[model samples]
Target: MSAILSPRPLIKENDVKATLLSPDFLRVSQPKTFRHSIDVYLKDSNATGNIYFARHFEWQGICRERWFFECVSADMLQSLGVFITKEAQQKYVSETFAFQKIDCEVNTFGVKHCSFSLLFRFFVGGELVAVGHQQIVFANKEKKIARLPDHILAKIREYEVEKGE
Candidate 1:
């Protein structure tokens, strides 16, 4: 007889966020968030009818592009040169079944000389399913790392302050 393996479900009552907080008051603030929805298609599912692991990255890309076009202008992006992905990380809290609608919320949490970070959270039916973080760096037309343009940075700062972040 052959053994079949199935994905394990995340157990409740173990709130990951609670374990990481410090007792001392840390001045933490939420970023301005952008929300987008992804409708899972058959092509995005695996044999088990759950969304394929790699599809999460694809959805994240969609969310990121939507955010860029909405919050900033495509022409502005072109004028500023290119933004390249530096690093990406994700933590899957639960599985998403096929045909489900996943709500993705994204926000910029950190910015620096030539790079910025976007945090993404995926939820299914109001339950947190995954969290992702991506770092992107500005680059020149020659593909060399470059400092973010002041105008763009100023716009981002204005948006952040407007959102009370």
Candidate 2:
């Protein structure tokens, strides 16, 4: 168990949970989600022979960084200081067996001054198995929270689906 960081925001935040936790995308995939994947192995399973629940968190992290590598810029990330997941929530839908490939669709939501949300949907054989939501923020070397840099925002916006889509 690790300490969690949340509730702290650089400025007054607005209502963003509806967008971040919406299940609409599960029904119809978002058009611009950055997709990433993982092939589950025995090592990823528990004694019950199902994937260890924590592995979803690992997948969420892997997919998030992969999005940064493929869509966002690493150099830009380096410019921002440290990254922290202010909050993370997940819903386990069905049992996932070993050897099944999991496709994690990543999309940005609720962008704000110094934090934003990411929605992660895990699908196997085109069926939703799990859902995850994470809110992330960055801080400077002095431990000051950093706002979303314009270039990074633009890159994220490119992957954002229009409202009501």
Which structure among the candidates has the greatest TM-score? 2
Maximum-lDDT candidate: 2
**Model 1: per-residue Cα lDDT over 24-95, one tens digit each:** 345465346678999998899988898888888988899888888887566648765898988988889999
Tens digits of lDDT, candidate 2, 1-165: 897777786444454555555687347644478988799999999877799999999999999889888888866477657668999999999989899999988888877768777888999999999988888887786778987678877787666653332
Model 2 sits at a Cα RMSD from the real structure of 16.3
Candidate 2: where is the Cα deviation over 4 Å?
1-31, 161-165
Error of 1 at 62 (Å): 0.7
Residue 78 lDDT, candidate 1, scale 0-100 = 78
Q: List the residue pairs that clash in candidate 1.
A: none
Pairs clashing in candidate 2?
none
